[model samples]
Structure formats: structure tokens, C-alpha cells
Target chain A: MLQVFPDLKGRYGDFGGKYVPETLMGPLQELEEALDQAMADPAFLEEYHHVLKEYAGRPTSLSYADKLTGHLGGAKIYLKREDLNHTGAHKLNNAIGQALLAKRMGKEKIIAETGAGQHGVASATVAAKFGLQCIVFMGEEDIRRQELNVFRMKLLGAEVVSVSSGNGTLKDATNEAIRYWVANCEDHFYLIGSVVGPHPYPRMVRDFQRIIGDESKRQFLEVEKELPDRIFACVGGGSNAMGIFYPFLGDTSELIGVEAAGKGMDTPEHAATLSKGTPGVIHGSMTYLMQDENGQITEPYSISAGLDYPGIGPEHAHLFQTKQVRYEAITDKEALDALKLLTQMEGIIPAIESAHALAQAFKEAPQMSQNETILINLSGRGDKDMATLMEHFQEEV
Target chain B: MLTKTSFQGKLTKTEDLFIPFIVAGDPSPELTIQFALRLQEEGADVLELGVPYSDPLADGPTIQRAAQRALKSGMSLRKAIELVPKLREHGLEIPVVIFTYYNPVLQIGHEEFFQLLGENGVEGLLIPDLPFEESEEIRNRSEEKGIEFISLVAPNSDQRIKQIAEHAKGFLYCVSSLGVTGERKEMSAEALAFIEKVRQYSQVPVAVGFGISTNDHVQLVRNHADGVIIGSKIIRLIEAEIENIEKGRMDEALKHFTKEIRALVQ
Candidate 1:
């Protein structure tokens, strides 16, 4: 009913635009037009809804983390179990939608870049399901850290290219992916993993993933009879945060975004952009990013692979600028601590990325009144991160 | 020092020369000064001192790798600007144009950036991210500071091309391809066509960029445009062949890369 992410010129405040090269301009314009037509096309909507519910596993549960919340001393913490989504994490919600849009556009190939490899795994999985050739660009470092995902992508019949340049992180990988897509722009649909990138991407991904908030809103009303006192999620490229944050953009609920502060905020190592950054553009859109003068991309570190990017999604930039949502940094120590506590107390070994939100809950829940409710989007289960976490623990011991 | 009018005066001539690009702080920010001095020593007509962004969406692997090394060595926009003073202190009076994206400029306030650029003896600014339509603020602010805000001319609508040509200061960067900046063996013919269009209407010199890699590419672009801009290829030459650019390897690498292009220019 409400126009999805309606703002000026497809911008989320001061951020978001097709700040791309001329090669992709025509196709991007065409895609924007096609999406407009598809949005109005009932057949397209019907097919999209059908695939979302049946294939990707929609309507994920919003289970309350009562025991964990009780231990934190105050507010009721609810978990929007997006980790239950097939292929893991909230990336699938938009990947399926974009892959379907690719189908409508008669595009044959799918390309994407991944950080923690969750988005790559999800995108490659959807591309396989759609019967399309998939190409994934991952940083060389990510390939080593997320070796299993690389192998999984290969097993799924997708071509995985390791980008070795430019800090070899998510942003660099995304740049390489865009370059690949630009050179091969004729028929490939770039399935951007999150709510970053230029114009239509941030807007489109937010629309598809808005189902998280829509469904959660209804479920909460049905269950608790009131909206959440606060909403929480991890911000990498920040899709899950936006998906869950978009519907409640104007709502009274306080939205909190947790960024990865690897080691600590002061070190050159952390990826806490919002906490220690000024306004700058990275990738395509103008947003807050950790960069130096002369414009060299800084190395962003995080214990959680997903929240390791130096720049956040444009909407988060806008929300942060407008003070609509509060953003804070959660250290690697805090996230790891939260991960273990959630696993021990709730039997939920949440992804380190999601552990950021859990850490936020641990800090904020203590100050919240008992009657107040906090919603934490448990973006993914921690299975993929087990090897890395174990290796980290073994090294520390 | 060339006045904006004097630079514009040079652009009015029909003859084309050479405009070479070098990634500032490629090996290290300290070494970048040496490279700038070396390029000047090597008879470079003009220099595009590329200020490396962390995420250079327009660059290929070669330039990206160079940027990584530079950033790792603590190269900042402030440091790049400071290089102007270092270069001047070293007595190199070549017009140093800061080749960077708009984000860093925006991050360091426009007035301050222009003032620092002017104070440090920077003559021009070539930012790929700042389209001409959104450049009025920068242009107005940079006017008295004697900073020339360079504009890019894409192979697009004649109207937009004309508008860019009219507004462009220093030189009109005529991109050789419609995509991001990179090294390519062959270039789009449409780029030549675009250059011809810009040459016809431009009040400034037309310099071809994006894929003008080899000497042959420069020769080809030279036939139509006023100047040739080569970046990724030169960066690749330095990156691939040498381990360090500072120990005088940068000049040796650039000598080989530039000799190939200069031969064609001659």
C-alpha cells in the first residue's frame, strides 16, 4: 500500500544513485523501467510471491529470546529468525527477487560479489535454482577465510573469481564484480548482495526484503499487541538492517544498527565507519566511509566477516544523517562474547554478523525497562563461521 | 605558473600533445614525489597525479593494487595535497593536477580543499566522480584559488558533450570507453567519434583517457584528440615489473612505458 522506500529521485536522503559508468547506463535505465513495469504487472508480483513463499521459505518465525533477555536484566528481546531462510541469512530474500526480475528481463547470466560468503552462497544458490550460469567475485582474503563457501559455489556450478587487489575485501571484490558485469553487461544480471551500490539496487533490495518488516509487524501486533520499543540488526552492506528497518522508518520504534568494531574503534583495523567516519563515497553512492585524504580505501577489520566493509549501505547513511536510526559499534571481543553467550543460553549459535545485534541487545537490554520489547534480526545461524571461530579460539589459547 | 586563461589559451590551439597520468603514492606517498619529479624530467607535457581512492571503481587490478600499497603506506588526501608543497620545495614547477574522486574532496570541505590545493601550488583538479552539472559549486569556489575544475566528456548526447566542452577548464577528459577506467588492448571507435565531437565544440584541449594504454592507442587517439591520458597501463608497467617504485624503479618503468607512447607522439 505505502509506496516502498519512496523518497526524492530514488534517493534515501542524500545517498543512493546510479553513479556508474556509461556502459551500464542504458541497461540500468532499462532495468529501472522494467522494474517499474514489473511492479505494476500482477503476473510478475504473483510469480515473485509464489517463489518467495514456496522456494525461499518466507514467513520466518519471530521467536522471543526470553531466557537470554531475562539474563540481560531487562527488556524482552525477540528474534526475527531470518537465519531459518533457505541458504541462510536474509540475502536470499532479495537474491530470489532479483533473480526472478532477471528472468522477466530475459537475462541469462547472474553475477555478484560477497563479503562473508553468505550473500555469494545465497545468490549462487538462487542462480542455480533459476537455471542460470552464475559468476561470483570474492576477495582473495575472503576466499581463504570462506573456503567452504568457495567450494560450495563451485559445487553449485558457479564460477568463483578471486579478486586479489585493493585490500582484497568486500568493496574491492564488488568493484571487480561491477567491472566484470560492465564488460559483459549485455545479458548478465548483477545480483548485488546487499543494500549498497547505485540507485535501483538499494531501493529494489530494500523493497524485496521489506517483507521482513511487514511480516514481523503483523506478527508482533498479533502476538504482543504493540510495536517494538526498539529494532536491532548488524550492518555490513546492511540489507537485513534495512529490510527490517525500512517498514519502521517512520514508526516510533527506535532502530539501532550495530557496526563491527574489530579490535577496537581507535585502531586502524576496525570497520566501524559510522562511528569514526566522515561523509565520503565508496563503490557508487555518497555515504560515510572510512577513507583517508587522497582517497585510498582503508582496510576494514572485523571478527565477523559480514560486517567487515568500510562503507555502509546508502539508506543507513541517510538514516544516520537524519538521525532516524542510532548506529553504534560492537567490538570483535563483544561480538565473540555475545556469540558464545547466545549459543550457551539460548542454544542459538548465531552468526558473528548477527552476534553484533545480540551484543547490542546485551548492552541496551540492561537499561531498558522490563515491559519494553526489543526486536533483534537474527540474520544467520553461526554454522558457516564455526571453523573460523574455532581456529581463532585455538590460536588465542 | 600557467593561468587558467593561459591554460585555456593552450587548449585553443588545434595541435595535440601528451598528457600522462601517474598514480600518486603508488609505491609510497614519499616515493610519489620522486615519480612526479621523474615524469617532469622525462619531458612530460602535463601530469595527472592520480590520488588513489581505496575503492577505485574506475580502475582495473593494476591501479587497484597500486592504490592498496599507497593506502597501506599511509597515503591520505591531505598527504597528496602536501605533496604539492614537497614538489615545489624540490623545485619541480610542472602543473600538478590532482586526479581524484569527489568523495575525498567532499570529505575535506570544498573551500578548504581548494585553498590547500592552491596554497600547496596545485594548478588543476580532475575528479571523475564530479559530473559537470554538479560542478558549479566547486567551480565558483575554486575560481579565485586559481584551481581549474576539469570536466569529463562522455561519448553521449551532443548537447551534454557541448555543455561539458563549454564549461570545462584545464582540459576536457574524453573517456575512450563508456565503462570504468582500465587497460584494454583495443578501444571503442565511438571514443574517437566522441573526441572529434568534443574537439569541434570544446573551448579546452581534448584529452582521451580510459583505455589509451599502448603507444599505438596513444597514436590513434592523438590523430583525433589534442592530448592522450594513460593511467592503468603505466601503473601496470610499474606494478608488474618492479617490486618497489621508489628505488628509482618507477622512472625506469615509466621510461619504458613512456618511450613507447612518446615515440608515437613524436
Candidate 2:
């Protein structure tokens, strides 16, 4: 219910703060100040919106899932179609905003990190459009898994550097990206992909992404004439979830964040940070982190490459602690099953990351009455996930 | 137990201070104590002992490899802090500073961590990630245990250098370059003027670190700053001798290590 949180030091209930090296302090402060000034300027906001509407296709449709609703025989389901946005995912929303800021700040080079490479592709697209050099860091393992997305980033003229440390996943890529930023922050801008990292990052990323919920709210109100009973969004560093859930926080809708259960939460192989993680620091912020008793970060596993992270966003940590939002875990099989169901039933292929939230909605939709409504943020298109899906369904086909 | 008062006060103020860093258990904690003694004998005024962590963000590739080796030997913040008493017993009496990332300390809990420092002979504490803004509680907690909490000022910390240096306890840890800890061919030429700015604000001694790789870097920084803290170079030197130390050739490694550090500092 709290609208204004994350006090001046960027502490979202003592969760988010700048835990970076001394070298990054001044730069972070400058970023915060610059972002604040930019957000306050009407010209900046106008330009950001102009790019979003004309280029990336803003007001992404909120379509009624009639077949899904009839299949469930309970709640009427609606999909917030972020998957239709430019770059084929919601990642472009934040990238466009941050890239504009980079150009405004006179930064010529942009550095980014990715897991499924959606964010990398988005950053690369914006950098190419804006005529700035782009460098993207991705885990070696991810590069192998998300080959199409990796190639797409390169096709956009971004250099894709493979990181091989710490399970060679998003966490490792983020570490390499931050290290590079620390070294070259004087000339480069770090275009973060999610609602994670230190201070102004989580805040600015959330603001840039809040457009999802804003558009959904308007569209839903126009159609249903009332807010949905429940909102579902997958939590991978919580960018899409934060984007869709933030505008509805003050509303009566119940917010649910679904995390990747990987094999299962019972097993060590899962990226269920909000469910199993404890309070600790990772990637320059104090949040719910999957780490051992000795404070060593443990590797997380998930079928969804985007969701395979050891830590959740600091805002999600705050929301979880405050009990304003409920957090749940969906296993890999359930996500796959839901993806298949959505593809077959509606001819809409959702990204495996978004399928986690889809699975959650499917499970709970049967419980609510038909008059009640459920809105799911279909965060990305599943085209990039074909490689991963084929590997899973090869024998079946 | 070694009496704890101040590395800030006890170390020689007349000459430029030489500080060498090594992971607590690269092979074993026993070797770390021996290494500490060797560094002390080789004119190390302060010993900055590190704890192996899974993700060390500020460290470059060289120290990361050393940390991985140390972690394989089960080195932790508790083990790193507890090693101080062993060093004292082995007749290695110098100002011991625990250099670690914040998560390990968070795992130990702040109260227990400070108590451990008090119980051991740790005179100084440095968490590179805890910048000036987020370190008030830690600074106060360290002061409660009489451990001087070191503050770091980087080349980019334009106006904040004064605010940070004003509260600095033992010595201001001046970053010699604009990046993570590594061995670089050339030091940032602006580092000289940066140290001068820090000196103007800091009441305590200024120790420059992060890529003090070559002897030229050491000499250049030594003339301008009160102390020179060497991390990646020492890790690199010890890494070269890891095979010899693992083979039970401690004396040979110690002699080689001392000669190597002696060249840089002297």
C-alpha cells in the first residue's frame, strides 16, 4: 500500500543500496542526479514517449483470452501483450528510455548484460538506432542456449562477449558487465536490463517499465470497466513484474510474482530467490539472494534462461517482506506445459520466462469465479526460445 | 593476544608504509601465517589478509584465481579473522587489516563480526564495497570495537573525496586507477594529483592501492602518498610460488617471495 518507499539512500526497506566499489560511488551519484533531472524535464519525457509510440509501438494491446477463459471455466483471463512490442519483448521499453538518457549524457558507448539475450537485443537495437557503440556480455552457457538471440545481437552491430565465470549464467555476465562499467564508466553507459542492481538503477528501471501496467490499467478499465482481481507476472530480476504490478499496487488487485522452481524448490537447482533466499548482497544491492551459510553465492538453475538468476530485484524483496505481494514458484515442467497450452489454445507463443506466470494463472484461474478477472503480462515472444524448446521436445516430435 | 590500539598510530610515520595482501588460505591457513611473518620480515608495515569469496566484484582475474584456490581450501571470513591469533603466536606482530567484501561479514552478522575482530588482533577493517554513504553503522560499529575502518577515495570521487576523507579512521585507501584491482602496465597519471587532493582532506595517512603493479608505480605513489598497499602484484607473486609452497618447499618460497616484494618497496 506504500506508494513512496526506497528512501534517499535507495534503501527499499533496507534492501537496495549502492554496495559497489568506491570507484562507482561518484558515478552512481551522478546517475541518480542526472536521472532525477531527466525525469523531471517535460522535454525528456516527451522524447521518451515519442520514441516509444512511433518506433516501439506503445499502448501494446490488452486482449481478452476467450479460449483460455473457457478452458479454465472460472476467471476471465486477459493478456497484456508486451510480446508484440518492438524487439519482440518488453525489454525495449526500458532500453529506449535508458539509451535516450545515455545520448543526453554524451556517452558514446553502451554496455549491457543478458541471459536469454532479449535485453541484449533490445540494447543493441537502441544503440544501433541511436548511432552509439554497443557491447553485450552474456554467459557462455547462455550463448550456447540462446544462440538465435546472440546472433541477433551481433546482427544489430553489438559485440557479444562470452563470460565463463560462476556457472556462466546471468549472474556471471552481470559481474563482468559491472566490472567493465567500473573500469570504463567514464565514457560508457551501462544499460541495465532489469529492476535490479544498485540505487537509481532499480528506481529508474522501474519507472521506465511502469508503462506496462499504465497501459494495461487503461485498456483493462476501458474493456472490463473495473480492475482485475489478480495480476500475474514472472519474476526474473522482477523487471516485467515491477513494470506491470507497480501501477496496480494501490489498487485492490492481488499481485502474484512467480519465480522459476527449476527442477523444484525442494531441490538445490532452482532460481526461487523470494521463496528460499535469505537477506544478503549480490551485484551491488542487498536483496533476497540464493547464497550459502558462508555468504558464498550458490548457482541457480532454471529452464528459462532469463529466469536463471540467483537474486531477485530489491523492490520484490521489499514487496515480499511487506506482504503487499505474494511470491510463488513454478517448476520447469509446469511452465513448459503452460507454454504448450497457450500456444495450442490461443495461437500465442509466450516466452518460457512468461510461461511461469502463465502456469501460475492457469492453476489459480480454475479457483476464481468466471465474472472475476485475471491479467497476465505476456512479457516476451517465444521465437528466441525455439532452440531450448527443441532440445526439450526433440524425442517427442 | 596482541594488544589492539591502532595500526593508524603504531606503524612508523616517518617512512612510506608498505602493505602486502594475501588470501587467508590459498593452500592452507598455516601457510598464510608463515606468509604474514615473511611479509613482516620483508618490511611490511601492515598485512591486509583477504577472505576468499564466491563473487569478488572489485577484484581482477589474478586475485579471482587466487581466491578460488583459497576457497577450495575452505577459507572464509571467520577463518581469515581467526588466523590473526596464529600469526601473533608465530611471532608475526604487525597491524593486521582484514580486507573482505561485505557479504561475508553480513553472513557472520555485524555484532558477531565486530566481536570476532575484538577477540582476534585485527586492528583495521576494510570492506571495499561499503562506500561512504552506506558505512555509517559499520564505521560506528568498528569504532566501538576500536578497529579503524578504512575509507577509499578513487580518481573519480571528485567532490566526495573531502566528505569521505573527513570520517576516515586508520588511513584513506586511495584507489590508484579508475578500475577494479589488477596489474596494469601503466598507472593513471591523474592518480598523483588525486592523492594530493585526498591528502588535503584526510587527517590520517593516505594509502594508494589497486594496480600498484610495477616498481615504477610503487615509487611514483610512494613519493606522493603516505602508504602503498599492494594486492594483485602480491597475489601474482605468491601465485607463481603456489606450486613450490604446495610441494612443502616453504623456505624456498618465503625467500623468493621476500626478495620479490623487497625489490618493489625498497
Candidate 3:
């Protein structure tokens, strides 16, 4: 079989490198070699695959969005229901893999950073199942807005620390998590919650979550008997996109990554990194980031907590530069409209982050030909976003 | 006392001059310019004006806190460049080195940056992230424009030490340790041993950086290496002061911090 994971040193087209401090060098190397050995071990893969199937529920179905298709009027659409996963998103696939890896490595604690709190909740749940200590870093503002996920994490026995500095948001939380991990490198394993970070992580998360694409490819062929003409997913830290895009990447399918167009790309209140940001190295890898003259990270703003970040994952940066995928963004208002439309019409209350993919489908479907098949990853359920959406639409009602 | 070129020449002669780095917009880019002048006044042989990147991988909490303050002040690349001309207009003649990452340098094109810096009376450059292998174009262009491009070598790496020592013109920045820059009480014995090893190979003068915080650290390296690079520790001093004082009190507080570092060198 073809090799999926990169070597101990992460190199994805001149973008990924092990730009970590000296202390992390040993553990990362150990993790890399351990993971390499574990991948080949039938027992490890059997245990992981069994848990994903019996416990977490794998092979999530692909539902055709006929109502969304009729509304858009140009092409037929389908939804890859990753929302049907045990954690209501595709994050569990990778989180389960990493948690198992942590157990094998004898790591007693799990550390992660969350923006929308989905990854944190997933990590917290997996940590509880594995009986490992978990600590999650979240922005102070996110703690208030994503209260349900915060409480869920606490209930699952994970301690959630609120970061108050540097805009008090996702990027700042990530920075704080890195600082914490540096001090506790001997005992704690940083789960990194997304496809970004130093090395090994970007590759590891993608390989674990490739189940989304693998299932979608086989399911689509069985259902429609043809490949998708286009595939769409949102790009906040880009794990879900990597999940769905990996199997389709080699195929002749057009991949579209929608980012948050907060107010507008022209203003500072946007999180459309791939569309507006320049190529720069940050957080131990080179990637596209929203930066100022001295290369200080600027504050990113979006209605969706999940989509607000200064930089994209390094692999996505490589993909964007190589033109393998076309990157675009939808405004917060546009995403909210799609959320309401999907909930009211299709009876699917999609998560605000997933609604970003819905909004892109809304835009691109109209331009596509009648025969074009667009597959959108409905990544998470909207149960956690009800309060946020209600508050956003409060002025109207 | 000298022109920027001649000062750069002296820097190249010894191959090491104690170049003190402070974030350009940390306290405010306006005051940062004043701070640069003060460092010159206190005998900072070369001025390293750090561009205050938000995600400073190599720095500790002190510099990170200062960067947060600088970003809040609406600091931009244009404003940082504008300060170069602003300082030169005020007659601060030391070789002002723009110590920055490769992103901003690439954002504003290479030729355009050199032209802007040339117009602003800047004379040297030090980018810690840009290794010698990937810096040939920038190095060639910088040398052609009479701006001495500085390079860094890890303490015990024989190849990097020799490569940097041979081609290094302005100064050789010898990283004191293998980790990020921070404050610590005493220098490591291994670091001292590495510094001794580098001094043997380095034809140009070498300056020890990365956690050289105390006066004792400065004095210890003063014998083996030509100078000391103090960054995060000095920035930490000003960050600690900002919460207590009013806006007008910052200059006095910053001046006191500079005075303490200058006193260490004396």
C-alpha cells in the first residue's frame, strides 16, 4: 500500500517543518516513531477501527439535499452527514485516534485548545472514556458564548482554562496551550484539536479523519455511480475539509474551502485567511496568516466562533498555493441566512461552521451546470449554536 | 560621533557590536524611536529595531506581552519604516538594523524594502529566522547596497559556526542556548563551553544572545564573545511598568530600564 504518513520530520511541500523548542524534540520524535510502528501493528489498528465502528459509529451516510438543490436551481446537492458522528462532528474521528495514541505513549494528560468548543468537547469525551486527565484552553469570550460545550467539557472531567489576553480568542488560546504544553512536556500530550500546529499533527489528523472521504467516495459511487463534480467544506483550522478532501484530492473533483468573510474581506473584522492573508511562517510552520507589517498576528473576528483564526493549516496553505483547491469566503450574514434556510426548509439545523459550507453551496450551485454534483460536508449539528443564532437575530424579533 | 557607513565598518571590523533589540512599537513606535535614540546615547553599538511580530516563536512571555501592547497601538509595517526616516531626521546616526521576520520583508517586495531603508538612512539587517542557506539573494542585495546583513550561529554547531564566521560581515550573533529567549539567573556551563569553542572558529566578533538577562551573564560573555544581546528581559521591565503609570509616565519608566542595562555594560 502507499505510505500515508510523512516521516518523523513533517514536510508537505516546503510548508511543514519541526520548528519546535528543544524540549519538544524528543517527545515529538518518539511520538512519530511510535505512531509509525503503531500504524503497522494489526492489534492497534484493529482496536482503533473497532472502537470507531462500535463505539463512535463510523461510515456516516450521505444524504441528498434535494430541497437545497431545488432552492439553488443550478445543480443537485448532497450532504455528507458527519453531524451524525457520535460527537455531532467529524472531530471525533481524529480525536479518538490521538487519544488511543496517547494511551499507547503512556501519556496521562491530554491538552487542547478550542474556539467553537466542538474539538474540546470531543477531546473531553474521549479522555473520559480513556480515563486520562484533560485540560482545554479556550478564549474568555468563547467560554461565555460556547457555554454548553464548556459545561459539557467540565461534566466529562476536563478542566477548561479561559485565556484573557491577545484578543481573548482562538489564536490566543492556541498560544496559551502551547505555553502550557512546553512546561509539562514530560507528562502531557497536546491533542492540538485541528490540522494545524508544528509537524506530524497536520498529517496525523488528516489520515485519521480520511474516513470521511473514504466513505463518501464509496457511498457516492454506490448511490450515483459517478464522482462528485465539486466538493465543499469550511476551513477553520481545516480538519473537516482535509477529511472529506483527501479521498477526492486525486480524483478530478473541484474542492472549494469557504472561509468567514466576517464583515467583508476589505476590513480587519474578517477571518478569510486564504483569501486575504499572505504566506508567512507561524506556530512552528509556514502558512497563510492575517498579519501586519512587523508580522504581528491581528485579531480575527467572525460570528461563528469556530471560523475565527489568524492562520490556516500548513497543508491547506500548500493546497491553496498549488491551486489544487479554490478558496473563497461567505459573510456572517450570508452564513446565518443559509443556516436559517437549511433549518427551516431542509429541517436540518446545521452548525454555524457547517452553514459556511451550505452558504458556499448556495453560491456555487447556482453557477454550476444542471448535471454537476456538489457534495458538501454537513460537519456538525446546530444544537450548540441555537443561543448564538438567537442572539444574533434578536434585534429582528 | 560617526556616519552610519563608518559605524557599520567598525561593526564589520570587530565582527561584533553589542546590538540591543527592542520591539519597534512595543511602548508605541513613536516612543520606540525615542528609545532607539536613547540606546544610541547609552552606547548601543548597533540598534536592532524588532518589528514586534505577534507570534514571536523565539521569544518568551516578556517580549510577547510587549508585542501585544505594540499591536494594540496600531503598529504597521509602513509605520515601522516611517520611523526609520523619523530617527534619521532627528540625527541618530548609529547603524539602525531592522530585525524582522521574512514575512513583512516579502509582503513589501525586496527591492522596494531596500530602497525604502536606503532612503531612511538604515545600514544593516538581522533576520534571526532566515538561515544562511536560504538568504543568498537578500544577502547579495544587502551587500550590494552597502547594508551589512548579519547572521546567527548556534553555540556548538561546527558547520554553522564556520559558515557564519567566514562570510559574516557586520556581526555574528551566537545563540547562547538551544531554546527560546527568556530570563534566567545563571548562564549554563555548556553554553559557556560552546561560546569558547565558537570564539576559536569565529574570525569576526561574536555576541551571545538567547537568555542573557543578568549583568553577570553580560560580564561572563564579555571576555569570550565581543558583546551581549539582551531582548526579552529589557522588554519585560517596561511591560511591568505600563499597568501602574499614566501615559506620560512611560518615557521615564522606559528610560530607567535602559539605564539599568547600560549600567550593566559599564
Task: Give native contacts recovered, as a fraction, per prediction.
Answer: 0.38, 0.85, 0.18
Docking class of 1: acceptable
Better-scoring candidate (DockQ), 2 or 3 = 2
Deviating ranges (above 4 Å) for candidate 1: A1-10, A17-28, A66-73, A266-269, A292-295, A366-370, A389-397, B1-12, B25-44, B68-76, B82-95, B143-146, B156-166, B177-192, B196-201, B236-261
After superposing candidate 2 on the true structure, give the runs of residues whose Cα lies further than 4 Å from its correct spot: A1-3, A395-397, B1-5, B12-14, B178-189
What are the candidates' individual DockQ scores?
A: 0.34, 0.82, 0.19
What residue pairs clash in candidate 2, if any at all? Answer: none
Arranged by DockQ with the best first, the candidates are 2, 1, 3
**How well is each residue in B124-163 modelled by candidate 2, as lDDT tens digits?**
9999899988899999998887788988888888999889
Q: Mind giving the per-residue lDDT tens digits that candidate 3 earns over A135-246? A: 9999998998889999999999999999876777898888788878866767898997778877778888888888899999999999889999999999988999998998
Q: Where's the lowest-lDDT run of ten residues in candidate 3 chain A? A: A1-10
- Candidate 1, clashing residue pairs? A17-A199, A293-B76, A293-B77, A294-B77, A295-B53, A296-B54, A297-B54
Show the colliding residue pairs in model 3.
Answer: A293-B77, A296-B54
TM-score of chain B of 1: 0.83
What are the per-residue Cα lDDT tens digits for candidate 2 across A333-384? Answer: 9999999899989999999999999999999999999899999999999999
